[model samples]
Target: MTITRRFPATLLALTLATPWSAWADRVYSDAQLHYVNFVQETDGMDALFRAMDEGNIHDVAIMGLGVAKKWEESAPKAPRYYMGDEAPVYYYSATDALLADAILERPAAQQARLHPFIAGFNPTDMNAVNHIRLMLDMHPGLWKGIGEILTRHDDLTALTKGETARANHPALMKVYELAAAENLPVILHSNITSKRERAPIYLEELVEAVGKNPDTTFIWAHAGTSAEIHRYQERVSGLHDIVSTLLAEHDNLYIDLSWTVLEPYLLDEGEPDEEWVALVKAYPGRFMIGSDLVGRFDSLASTIRSFDAFLNALPEDVADGVARTNMLALLPE
Candidate 1:
């Protein structure tokens, strides 16, 4: 559900008080549109609570993997390496920096509304350079208020060298290190793409790195993807030799059903019920439910319905694990 379209925003970097506060702003044109008011809408963490009440699924805790205010721009361009291009504004600058500034500058409730739940960020679309550049180029036209903010702020380019190899690797490691220190479960993104040739292999190396860190509890995205399965067999003959922390790497790691394109393209559409049930059971405490919800691109109902469909396919015990048990184990009491 990684919609490749976007509206532009301020590209100025702010001198952040904390690294996470590097820069922050509203993701949507109308602040009310974003899913920030989960509690206001339904009383608690809205979706999880609803799922529990309806018996659609429950017991799992949710941690959003990526949270950016909006696309730097959407001109249908993609990064050559999916991981290389983060939303443009995440770069660096000082003058116009807000969110951190705004959080400090504004009231507490207003700031809390801006922060997203999860620590790590993932942009699953491919064709990074143009996909990102086109949007940046278009910023002036679409979101001028943000453009004004950028005008007043400093513009910073990527300090990380070799964005694909070293840059992404380092950023990921930094986040993992923080999460591990907090003893929080780390959802190492397994965001996969069939069309991108070497994307999966490069990403696999990073996942292996996280697996090597014992303090970090890793969750693989998309069940390691078909490419991961094929490559592990064809290339390494399934050794996974790059150093890992978890003893049962495959079983200990988790992957959510979100981040996939279509039902059939993923696993089995016809007998998905049995297949998903078996797969969830096979993972044990490791697997947890994730939506990778692309609200700007898709309808919330459709996204939830898809989760519902996956739940319907699972055996009751397996569904219970995915919907509740696995998530509960990952999150703190």
Candidate 2:
């Protein structure tokens, strides 16, 4: 029962007529749409699709549980510090099980392009491993990957009494082992350090996980970005060297070049960093771009377009790989 929505004629005509730079042309097309990392709600799928259509993105790896509750009802109960009175916040519970069901229930055409990742939240929860196994058992083919699994997440850890999940915890190791056995990629969001000093305190857990599980492919979400880290800290010095070292050491590791978090490291004074360019060229297949859009669709095009400069700086083949090809390659066969 999949439905394939054809691109609108006007959009198609525009896509063909626009003389985008050679790099831009390589990243998008009618037959080939850029892949995105999606955090979508069940009620908002149509809007997401529309946004994707507008952005010329046909495929998405849906992350999180997909917006379970309304923001007002789910807002933090404590009187937390606030910088702005009107800062936007969303509260939703998206489980991997729910996301898998949503994708499976889509029309056949849509299902073909939507890949769902299983969620394994709360490593301390005794049932976390069993819960993930149950979901995988129930829907054998519905999910293609695992995570945006929260490890050392500041906001989430705050909600859980400051108990940060560790990548190599016994419970998480079980889950990672399962992912490897299933041949599915695992997307992990493990911040490198808890403090704003860019000390790389908690990075060893990630390195250990990758080193231990050579069979499993791990996509380091946001390339170890933390919004809270950025808000308090100055730029992380030698970030590129650290990342390049990780890539060189681990064949199983990949980076999610999502928005805002990676913007600083990728560019230097609004220009592409030559060192970053060389690193990417050396391992062209190791990067993928994601809008990291949650529940909202308006910024879709702008987010994807933001990477144009970064993409333009790379060799055509490597740029294409980062922009779209690598994501497709990671999908379940």
Which prediction has the highest TM-score against the true structure?
2
For residues 209-243, write the lDDT of model 2, one tens digit per residue: 89999999999987776677777775555768889
Q: Against the true structure, what is each candidate's TM-score? A: 0.47, 0.80
Off by over 4 Å in 2: 1-43, 66-94
Model 1: residues >4 Å from true position, as ranges?
Answer: 1-162, 165-168, 192-194, 198-200, 224-247, 250-252, 259-262, 265-267, 273-276, 296-298
Q: Ten residues in a row with the worst lDDT in model 2?
A: 29-38
TM-score, model 1 to reference: 0.47
Distance from true location, Cα of 259 in model 1, Å = 4.7
